[model samples]
Target chain A: MAQPNPHNTYLPGYKEVGHHEWRTAENSAPYLLPTLQSLAETNPSLTLLDVGAGSGTITTSLAKYIPQGHITAIDLSPDILSRAASHAASVNATNITFQPASVYELAQTFGPAAFDVVHAHQVLCHLDAPVQALAQMLAVVKPGGVVAVREIDMRVWSFHPFSETMRAWVEVQKATHAAAGGSNEAGPSLVAWAMRAGARREDVKASMGTWLYATEEERRVWGTSFRDRIVGGEMRKKALELGIATEAELDRMGEEWQRWMETEDACCGTLHGEILIRKPK
Target chain B: MAQPNPHNTYLPGYKEVGHHEWRTAENSAPYLLPTLQSLAETNPSLTLLDVGAGSGTITTSLAKYIPQGHITAIDLSPDILSRAASHAASVNATNITFQPASVYELAQTFGPAAFDVVHAHQVLCHLDAPVQALAQMLAVVKPGGVVAVREIDMRVWSFHPFSETMRAWVEVQKATHAAAGGSNEAGPSLVAWAMRAGARREDVKASMGTWLYATEEERRVWGTSFRDRIVGGEMRKKALELGIATEAELDRMGEEWQRWMETEDACCGTLHGEILIRKPK
Candidate 1:
């Protein structure tokens, strides 16, 4: 039997209800399309690895880009990994293989130089050892292959009809994430993290992306989901356990989200930092 | 003679030193390309208006998209307008016409339904009356034409190798801009402003864009230009005038930029909000 994965302490657990709906792979993976398409064209039979492949949503959607390519999706939680496998089967994504693994153990599981591309989205920021995780990811990619990662640069979130409660919610969220040893605003630090992982600066390409929520429908989807996460989900549980916020305060935040959703002129956006690190040939 | 354009109190005057090189037209206008290209295809002889056409850098570049079209570039400052005219001449952008004008006078100057598109970039945020200016822009556009605007949503800036002084710099910049009666963070509120200016919610389309400076060269260019603006250029003058920061503090902020440029692991990004509103046909 294997020892437990310590990084399982990732805030806002994915198994929490509504996590799948709030962050689907299809919605989140569009930003990575162009790069993945280019890679697929360059190597039709590419072997790609998706670390921290929560819900396997992005991994399965990525399958069509290279019909001839194979994707091995891994997550720390077997429960989520099994669900991801069932999802891939239901979606007819025949090219993907699901497995349970840790981000820190990529080299041991796949051996060195095993993959053509190693990718993780919104993953690194949650780890206490992101630099080491990146190093392990770099170790498993073939020379001349690439490792791509994207994480929310949560330092600034833009919202309209701004409310004090919402602002407090953002602060509390960041505080809790930090207390758990994750970097909430990890977007801009990607290049530095890659460089620290032993990749040369020249081989790293850094860019920015964004997620916008406006219109009544978009606001409702994001607002209500976020409210649920804050009030009754893993985030709430973590906040209470960590004493980051009192139960009354968490309840107020949930109400604030409701108010925000009801406002006629509501808009919110979060910026993301993305990087592509090519293994030196 | 023109009552000294009240909006000319715009913070960080353009005529101030180093302004032109810091924000050239070409670098600032790429975000509007797809929209311009699509409009060009729809109407080859597109009669477009570039409001606040500072330095004519973006205006001259926009000329190529609609070779058959004509552009009337307007600004409140005759001094900058002359420079813009000279720039257009040097670049052989024969289709562009530069003139001295104010955002509030657009309808009176161009007449109603005079152009196919009225576009502004980094323009509206500096006004005491952005909604009125937007309404004027709408008035001058043809019934089916579009009015497009992009503004820095200054609410959040993402930077790496974070520093307290640099953070203080951001706060002071916002404060000075606000003191001048400008909305420094006009990006996210664009839709609200448009609606207040009489645009229907359905007719407005909102999106987000970003400016990234990460590479050594990029960091140097942005950092140094910003330092110049903070220490000796328009920003410094405005900061002192508004009493937002002491001279010594402003000097330190400028030095901080220099230090940041020298730091190998430097990255910064700013988010902008963009909107396109179509006149109801």
Candidate 2:
């Protein structure tokens, strides 16, 4: 539903099929963990709704912080949510419910005020109607609840010891973003969209963070895995179906990742931020 | 800097600047809020450290959720971190301690096991030595502490109702990724890089998510912003300086974003995911 690439890590069996999860916990912490902590502080008995909850990584964490809180997780793919359920079991987590649902159909599936916290992690950048999705989330959360979001603002990016290789590569990153209907400026947009939709400024908050990888091995190998296994696989299939790209485009997608593996150098990636809002009390 | 162009939200006397924070809060919540809930269930009292705590998006969240937990927020840019500190102050949050430091110098600045949780979102993709950044994070977290990451997996992308304009635009996208030492498949390698670097699979947890913009307006308007402002900007500046892309090639980037915008149809953009791992206890 998100992308045509079912083979991506965003799908399933990504790790088993030689896929990588980008930078691991070490590289991801500064931006992700603190934001998670900030989000958890909203309500003591928070009831959370995770739209597009893939593989249950965050679901398990929600169970840890809000032991008694209610959690309802949804995804368009049951195949993926099933794995998430398994993850919950692996972590011995309870108090969380999993379901298969699309963003467009969420209003019909969930009742009003069904959750104290309506959360979607890195979700909007992949949707056809991210703002509409946010609207739907607004509809689902209780009036007094909080709605939180996280996005990678690729627009605020910079580099060091830059090269032509880096420049060309960033273009690919933007292409990736364009095809997804995501703005490299998506993180900053959250605030304006919220206000336009009626949320006030005082109740809103936004922050920025990034993951910086230090090696070409980490960049290319992991980059290829992220592409073919997690994303490029899906894009290739989709473009082929759409006839937007020739066989060559698809092949190049595969080759680029390989080329990265063979090359030597490092990369830096920065995550812009997650903008969070508490529903009006 | 996480992005080459951050919409200049920091411009002096920029009232529209608040719009940045507002929109991020609005749009991001449809996803951001849920991720925090999921993270809460997983050892939320994390001795959290926020790297590049720009505007305090993640750092502030930590203060609210893990009120008793201590946070050492680090950033290299005084301007951005100052904004982060201000946001923390506005909320009267005290649990967070903001520091001016660089990810490259993290290990040298902190002692061993200094943190229980380290998280970054969309950061690793921008670094020259992303693995080294991860290594630094590993050096800080207690063995059992979780390190989580999130990034864009650009390969599964597509823009339907395709045209030559969209095709060229996509070409630019791929070029950007290839040049930046990034791969469409970089998302999954995140976990593998850690495992290969002495972390265990069982100790690792990875997940994926995405965002999609539905309307042409959402896709084109916000879409063109990133393409023109950052991706194109960075490439042209670098190309002109490095002599890789001629002035002609540099000019093409703008044409590309414009061409995509002119295409009238619903388009899809990027998909993303997360990789959460734990070092051996």
Candidate 3:
């Protein structure tokens, strides 16, 4: 069994929430493509199994990318599915087939080994039984097929300017993770997160998580402070060149090592980091 | 001198705008309060001066903390100043003095060395000549007094799960910055941002910047991927302890990222962060 992660719990009304529009250019190409691309490479005719596909953003992108693929996406929200249906239509993607269902009960409705690629982004982190869900997804992927997932690790945030307010905010996050009975691991520690998610060490390196930082300073600070160290100096320098964050913010952040470290736990000095992983057969 | 950040070039029809209620608890305190707080420590009376105080969120917080100190706040927007006046009255903070005035021409109105602590939040970053404005703030503050300023980096943002239609809404920030010929450090790089207003080093460390990830995954990913070092066993663990984004929307963010990165050179990336700086002793 994976060790308990105190941070991935849930609070009734305090889930980390955001819209679909915030994804950046760097994140889209890899997480959203590989599975579909691999499937397309092997098939003359394709049917997609889009799990927890919200608002058909992926389905829409699929239409734009591989217009020939037939899509069947499943979700529990009619409010979302209805919009996904509309979005699919708006994008002029007619081959999509969406169902109002949960991954828990999805296989019951559809036959096993039905899709060329069973895919999702940031989904398993929310489920109570992720391993079982993975099993379900595996059952649905034909032998030699692919299962793709994208996740964000919150443990990567290393540069929060300290304050009483940030302290309170971190507390709220801790409470949410505790509430979830420890099944979630998306916050800053993506490597450990991958291990907990059942990924092997080799896979972690193969699919490095791509994080989005606001400024060069943040990226630099994060690069120096986060564990994965997958990106830092060059990435931060590029962001500076690209105008992400200021050198001053990055410098001040370096001086700020004390505040995030004030916790009596002795380990407060380090914050979060994120990583992306994939399974290759 | 710096090729007026491409993001700062002006657009044809856009106008200045600010959010009284930023969706997340942006913790703008780092960018504005550090300078003011440092100043407060030296001058026991903590008498305060608020330039372009707008609706006086700081004025109220100051009054709450320094009940014995006198407070004077000014703003050019009579409409906004009226609200400050009413709120001061409602709070029974008679020690605060409000004036209707413009920051562009402060010397003609408020006397020199009028305050021990001068402050403004989310104000200077929007002006035409921020340097002149910072100098004006210096003029109002006593030689040994502190002058503080805060602003939203306005750059680092993942609007998704917050507002989907404008998920790449940070483009709006770049557009606004480019139009002004100012540095694009308005968002996630607020720490470095204060320097644009001409803040010095001692004035900066006390003043900091903050980044709020929407979920535990974000925090963890940041820590492990970017914040950690080559010598590591996950330096420290940062758990999702909170939910900041949903599984479905976050999963679909990759597609949004792709579209978000496709802006004119003037617009790109999510920009958001805050900075607080103190005037010199």
Candidate 4:
């Protein structure tokens, strides 16, 4: 049996969540590409640090932006890190390296003022000490280096025509996230977190972007992925164990999701807040 | 001299802002159309109560959605309402009727349960009593009717590459909005407001969407519009009179905005939250 993560309430199910996240990360290019391109504009050969690089999806995609640059990708899960390494190797992305590490230990391991750009996507929301981790990230970046973070504000996740099942699902998801010490408001709170982490308010720039799953194929993939996660994955198990939802409720939600996916005009929007802060030189 | 609206801080300059808003509303179809379509899905013949129908841009567009139904469009400003009526007449949209009314007086004017849909775009944020107005909207909406509201959370309005002038422009805009008794955080607070207005939590459905100005024409139009608003319009006068920004600062911001807009990859994202609350049958 795996040990329960004191900080993470969704343990024994993170691996499955991590797998789903890999797919989610892959489809996030629309949101991530622009930020990456912005960072690469000034220095194509920049050194990059990727925090919580699950399954190396974003990391590998990021590799294309900096052909001459090197990437250090870190995650806390050794299993996931190994899987990331294998994926990178299969892709012939030799410029990237995967290592098992925690956000808490970043500054200690990398020393101060280490990288040209530090980036994290959907990482801080899951951590117990997001501010401290952000501080660590800021500490390790060289002066004038950029620290970019992207996160979701799940409170804004809503659907129209008013489905009770979808609402219940959202509530359960939020509860599960909270139980795991995650911040559902992380996206909108990025700048405040950065400022709290000691970055100057004037240095932080915040913008909003979205990932819309509107096409048939996109909706199917998105809906089915959540369906599977809820039915057979750790989310189902944890949700039940935590008493956040009943098995019947989850099942009904799964059906509602499927029905929603089948509706011709059905679309989903995921809102993300992007913050880029440059350390004063 | 115009009476200073206790609830609105931008009274003296509202005419100019309202004119600018007309132009803005003309371009808002991409954001408002889908929501209207969704509400009209089951009921093609929708009797729509359009609150704050400035310039009749959205009201006329909405006429196409409910060809068989009628629209009651209202606004407080007689000048803008006249403009809206002229526009509606020019468009030959016979389904919409323009009137001067306040949100607080909706229920009294229309009586209980008069319309199938009560819709407002970017209106509630400008109200002194958003929740009370919401209650009035709810009162006049028939049972099982839908109340759709869209508002912006200006906090998410941002620009990249860190321009001090741009920041100042945003602050001035924010202050001007505050002076007008507008809620900069209204978009994210929709659901809460609905609940406070006595709607059941489950009856309210909230979703977020964005408008992006990234294409050359889009950037040019967006940039130039703001540039004009800042340099020559009443926003310029109010921003200076209120001491939110200096004339020189506004000039520099105008230049910086033009420069930002001209950048090849420059993109602007305007985040909006849409809520649909169904009256209990």
lDDT of 1 by residue, A1-281 (tens): 23234565455563443435455544565556787788888889999999988788788887878789999999887888888888888989999988888888888888899999899988889888889899989999999888988888867889887778888899878877777679976998998899899988889988887777887888887888888888887778878888878999999999989988887767888888888888988
Model 2 DockQ class: incorrect
* lDDT per residue (tens digit) for residues B1-281 in model 3: 11122122122211112223232212444344445555556664777777766666667666665667788888766766777788778878778888876665665567677777676765665665666666667677776666666554443342222335334223433453545455444332344344555665445432223344333333333323322211111111111112323333333343343333331111111222333344555
Candidate 4 residues B227-249, lDDT tens each?
Answer: 88888877888788898888888
TM-score, prediction 1: 0.92
Estimate, for each residue in B89-129, the C-alpha lDDT of model 1 and write its tens digit. 89798999988877787777778899988989888888888
Q: Model 2, B1-281: lDDT tens per residue?
A: 13122222211222222322422322322233344445556766657777756567656765566666678888666777788788888988888888887666667788778887776655566554566677777887887676766656554343433456545445555555555665545564565556654666556554444344434556565556645543445544544554455665545556665655564433344444455566677
Which of 1 and 3 is ahead in DockQ? 1
Alpha carbon lDDT at A143, candidate 1 = 97
- Backbone clashes for every candidate come to 2, 147, 122, 3
Which residue segments of model 4 deviate by more than 4 Å?
A: A1-42, A90-92, B1-281
Q: Each predicted complex: what DockQ?
A: 0.72, 0.04, 0.01, 0.07
How accurate locally, in lDDT, is each candidate? 0.82, 0.58, 0.48, 0.73
TM-scores of chain A, one for each prediction: 0.91, 0.74, 0.61, 0.88
The C-alpha stretches of model 3 lying farther than 4 A from their native spots are A1-281, B1-44, B159-164, B173-184, B187-199, B206-281
Docking class of 1: medium
Candidate 1 regions with alpha-carbon error over 4 angstroms: A1-9, A14-32, A89-91, A242-244, B1-9, B15-31
Model 3 per-residue lDDT at B260: 31
**lDDT of candidate 4 at residue A237, scale 0 to 100:** 81
Choose 3 or 4, whichever is better by TM-score.
Answer: 4
